[model samples]
Target: METKEENFPNDSTMESIKSLTEKDAKTFLNLIYALIKDNENPSEQLISNVLTIFEKQLPRVAKARQNKN
Candidate 1:
C-alpha cells in the first residue's frame, strides 16, 4: 500500500504549513474538504473569503515567505 508520504513526496508547502496551529490546520482542512465535496465550484468571492481566513491565521508565515523571495 502506498503511504501518504510516498504519494506526496517533496511537498515544499508542508514546511510553511507547519507553522499553523493544529486547530487552525484542521479548520482550514475542513474548509477545503467542504469546497471539494460540493457538486458545484465555489464562487470567486467564496474562494477569496476562504483565502482571507487562511491568511488571517498565517500572516507571519506569509510575510516570512514573501521576505525570503
Candidate 2:
C-alpha cells in the first residue's frame, strides 16, 4: 500500500520558524503561551498581536539568511 503526504497551509510559516534564532523562538513561544494561558478562546486582538510579532521577526530572519549566504 502507498501512503500519501499531507500538506499544511502554514508550511511556509513553519519554514520561517526554522530560521528564527533560539532567543527569538523562545520569546515567540512564551508570548503565545502568555496570550492563550488564561483564555479558552483567544481574542482577535491577541491573534493580531501574534501575527504582528511574527511579521516583525520575518525581516530579521531574512537578514540572517542573507548573511549566511
Best by lDDT: 2
Question: Which residue ranges in model 2 land beyond 4 Å of their true spot?
Answer: 1-12, 38-42, 61-69
Clashes of each: 0, 0
Candidate 2 lDDT: 0.66
- Candidate 2's displacement at residue 13, Å, is 3.7
Poorest 10 consecutive residues by lDDT, candidate 2: 1-10
As a TM-score, model 2 comes out at 0.49
TM-scores of the models, in the order given: 0.41, 0.49
lDDT for 8 in candidate 2 is 27
Tens-digit per-residue lDDT, 1-69, candidate 2: 423432222555666777777886787788778877765555867766666666666556746765997
Q: Model 1: per-residue lDDT, tens digit, 6-65?
A: 534243445547655677567678877786567275576566655555545456554565
The local distance difference test score of each candidate is 0.59, 0.66
